[model samples]
Target: MIAFLKGRLVEKTPTDIIIECNGVGYQVHISLHSYSLIKDSESILVYTYLQIKEDAHTLYGFVEKLERELFKLLISVSGIGGNTARNMLSYVTPKDLMQAIASNDIKTIQSIKGIGLKTAQRVVIDLQEKVQKMYGLEDLSTSVYNTNAEEALSALEVLGFVRKATEKVVKKIVDQQPDATVEQIIKLALKSL
Candidate 1:
C-alpha cells in the first residue's frame, strides 16, 4: 500500500491532484475536503489509499489520517464503492459522518448524493456499532434524552448563533441539568451563548 505521498503539487482541481515526487508525477483522486486543505500548499504530505482492482489501480488521498480511516470504513460496506465513499466524504466532514453513523441517523447518510434508502440503512446497520466502539460514542438508543440540547442548539442557530459554539453551551447546560426542558435549555443556553 502507498501509505502516503510527500511531494510537490503539480496540478490540482476539486476532484483530483497530481503530485511530483522524485521526478515522478502521481495522479491522485481526492475529495473536496482534501483538495481544500492542500490547495494553497506547494509541498504536502497526503495519506493515501491505493485501491487495486482487476483492471485498474486507483489512488485516493486524504489530508487527515481520520479522513483516510473514514474512507476505508465507508468503502468496506458491500454496496459502497470508492466513488460513492469519496462522494460521501466530499458531502460531509468525517466527524459528521462518524456522528451520523454512531447515532443511526440514516436520513443524514441518505442525504448524500447517490445513496439510497437501503444503502443508507445498510451503512448505519453495518457500521453503527463499529463507529460507536471505535470513537467511544454513546449509543443514542440507550442514552439519555439529548433532545433538549439539540433543540437548544437549533434555537440558538435560528437566532444567528453558531451551532458549534451553541452546542458546547447547550451541552454544558444539559449535563448540569439532564431533565431540563427544551425551553429551559434554550433559556440557559441563551445566557451562555
Candidate 2:
C-alpha cells in the first residue's frame, strides 16, 4: 500500500491536490481542513489512505495523522462512505467533531450538509464511547470554541440566526470582552442581529 507521499504540490484546490513526486503526479483527494493546513506550503508530506476498488483506486491525503485517523474512524460507521466522511471533515475540524461526538451533541453533527438526524444520531451512538475512550476528557478542553462562546453560538443558530453572521458579531463582542458569558454573548448578538 502507498502509505504516504512527499513532493511538490503541483496543484491545489479545496477538495483535492496533485503532488508531483519523482516525475509522477498523483491526484489526492482532501478535506477542507487539510487544504487549509497545507495551502501555503510549496512542498509537503501527506499521510494517505488508499481505497482500492475494482474500477478505481482513490487516495485521500491528510496534513495530520490525527485527521487521517479520524477519517478512518468516520468511514467505519455504517452508511458513511469516504466522500461523506470527507464532507463531514470539511464541515468541522477534527477537534470539534471529537467534542461533538463525545458530548452527544447531535445538533452539531446534523448541521453538516447532507447529514440527517438519523445519521447524526448514529454517528454519536456508534462513535461516542470509542472517541471518549481514545481522546479522553482532557483533550476536549482545547476545542474550537470557549464553552461560553460555543453555547452562545449554538443558541443563536437555533434562533434562526445564520452562523457566519452570528459568529462575526459574537467574535467582536468576545474580543471586546474576553470573559463574556454565554448569556452576555447571546444577548449582545441578539441586539446586533
What TM-score would you give candidate 1 relative to the actual structure? 0.76
Error of 1 at 67 (Å): 0.6
Q: Which residue runs does candidate 2 get wrong by more than 4 Å?
A: 138-193
List TM-scores for all candidates, in order: 0.76, 0.71
Report the Cα lDDT for residue 34, model 2: 95
Highest TM-score among the candidates is held by which one?
Answer: 1
lDDT of 1 by residue, 101-171 (tens): 98777888999999999999999988988888887776543244456666667778899998878866766
Candidate 2 TM-score, true structure as reference: 0.71
Clashes of each: 0, 0
Please list the Cα RMSD from the true structure of every candidate, rounded to 1 decimal place.
Answer: 8.0, 7.5
Cα lDDT for residue 39, model 2? 60
